[model samples]
Target: MKKILLSAVFLFSALSYAQDVKFGAKVGLNISNLSGDVEDTKSLIGAHLGGFAEISISEKFAIQPELLFSMQGAKSEYSESDVDYSYSEESKTKLNYLNVPILAKYYVAEKFALLAGPQFGILMSAKEDFEFSENDNGITDSGSESIDAKEFYKSLALSFNLGASYSITENFFIDARYNLGLSSIAKDYTDEFGNSTSLKINNNVFQFSVGYKF
Candidate 1:
């Protein structure tokens, strides 16, 4: 196991050494959703703020890694009889780690390019809020209560990124990307009775960013 780990590290370092690093910050809108039992929560609106470094291995290839505080989750709602219950949860998912994304850039023209790559997100700080009814007064008075909960990270989740960039000058560019999450964020939950709980989370993010490509 140690040998395998060392080998993987060596290979990654070799690849990284072969690329040039481009540093930048990105802020974008997030349109997220929750799958599985949490389906009632439609597209949840959120945002992402982070900084990234793109390592250029060649003129058309690079490895980019980032640290971002990304907010992702869903909005859920249900009604019982005349009483209504609904809540939308947004997780201030702070991901702190090195994300090494090997990107393949194909230039459509001198100022236009398309990029495709895979991203691994390591969640650092994860928090969630619950707005529930304490009583059944008109479906709980239509009032709300919120509580902060801990979200445990199940290690790194795989994701795919596809985007296009337009460079107006040597130091300026605009990028539009679609990131698809490929892991289930559901950690096993058990009550005091030792029974398992059915709760799951997945990654689904849409990002649009404009940056200075210095």
Candidate 2:
């Protein structure tokens, strides 16, 4: 029993010493948009900065987990009509999140890899900028406002990421990814008519990043 235990410990130590672990930092740009129940929506340009750790499990496989500060949202326009006037509004919504993703990577070539994973995001802030115009008897009124939108959005979000990474050198790489939201971002609320409704918005983002490994 003592000899078996000693042998097991030696094997474990050998495996640990053979594993390759690396750490790095990254910065990127995001083109984000919201989908579902919205009209005339456009993509918003945002940015992300983060750090990550990659643990090599085999020659062709690795696990990477990252912590990132990400900015995402959309731009939209809509028109409404009343008995006396017609109005149009344009809005841009901004959301800030702290995101964590755990990815499984498989190397297909010596310097290129494919990764897919689940990501969890915690909302940090939300805001909306609005521009409004109304026409009454051909007279036009235009104004703008900025408002806090945090209460209208969910605090937690879930997404799936599909991406590829190419190593440019021993310590540098470029990454491209798409994130698809699996959970709705809107909070439930009552409308002006006392009917319960939700915005039913989901986030979609395409990200490009440059990273360095140490």
Candidate 3:
């Protein structure tokens, strides 16, 4: 990322001198999940809040860059049964991130625009809630674990976003977007047997938001 930051800075400087520059603030809901090499996983509900600048390049096009704090992750469940015993487990992973997205927006209609861009995310925190239950010969046992999950996840993630925004008025708008992760979210390491193993997981998130321009 140094190159990305440099490019953002240059673009921001160029756009700052343009006409029709608008600033806005937004808050949104996120439905996030982990995809690839994982089973029994479901979407995790989260939130994101941020600010953005819309720099007009022409009558029907602009560059929108945003800084956001996002919460994302997934819920998972696993179960197994044998003739004499049954076991079940559930887990929820929480990942917090600071995200920057530089989007190119094209006005498709008078009040609607399509947006697509690359987003870079910096992981802030990771945690998990785990619960397990077992039944053997009519006896049952249950337990729970709260874990710090940062060690299992990578520090940075890259994703691409595609979405649309509709303007409700001159200053109010609504947005819907889907982010598809391009980088593996987990770290690579060697196992006890000197074999390399890594969890190949990527983030998938759907976002909906409302915004007001200032």
> Model 1: residues >4 Å from true position, as ranges?
1-20, 80-102, 130-142, 151-155, 198-200
Who wins the lDDT comparison?
3
lDDT of 1: 0.61
Tens digit per residue, CA lDDT, model 1, 1-214 = 3533553574478465674566787666777665554545667677777776666666765555556666666665544444443433333333332334445666777788888876666655454544444334444333344433435556566667888878867877777777776666667787899998766567766766666654
Worst 10 residues of 2 by lDDT: 1-10
Location of the lowest summed lDDT over 10 successive residues in candidate 3: 10-19
Give me the candidate number with maximum TM-score. 3
**Root-mean-square deviation of every model:** 4.7, 7.8, 2.0
Q: Assess the local accuracy of residue 151 in candidate 1 as a C-alpha lDDT between 0 and 100.
A: 56
For residue 103, model 2's alpha carbon misses the true position, in angstroms, by 0.6
Which stretches of candidate 3 lie above 4 Å from their native place? 81-85
Q: How does each model score on TM-score? A: 0.71, 0.82, 0.90
In the range 3-104, model 2's lDDT, one tens digit per residue, is 335534543553474478889999999999999877778999999999998878789888787899999999988888887889998899999999887777
Q: Tens digits of per-residue lDDT for model 3 on 1-214?
A: 8858876786777586667889999999999999997887999999999999999888898889899999999999999999999999999999999999889899999899999999999999999999999999899999999899899899999999999999999999999999999999998878899998878899999999999999
TM-score of 1: 0.71
What TM-score would candidate 2 get against the native?
Answer: 0.82
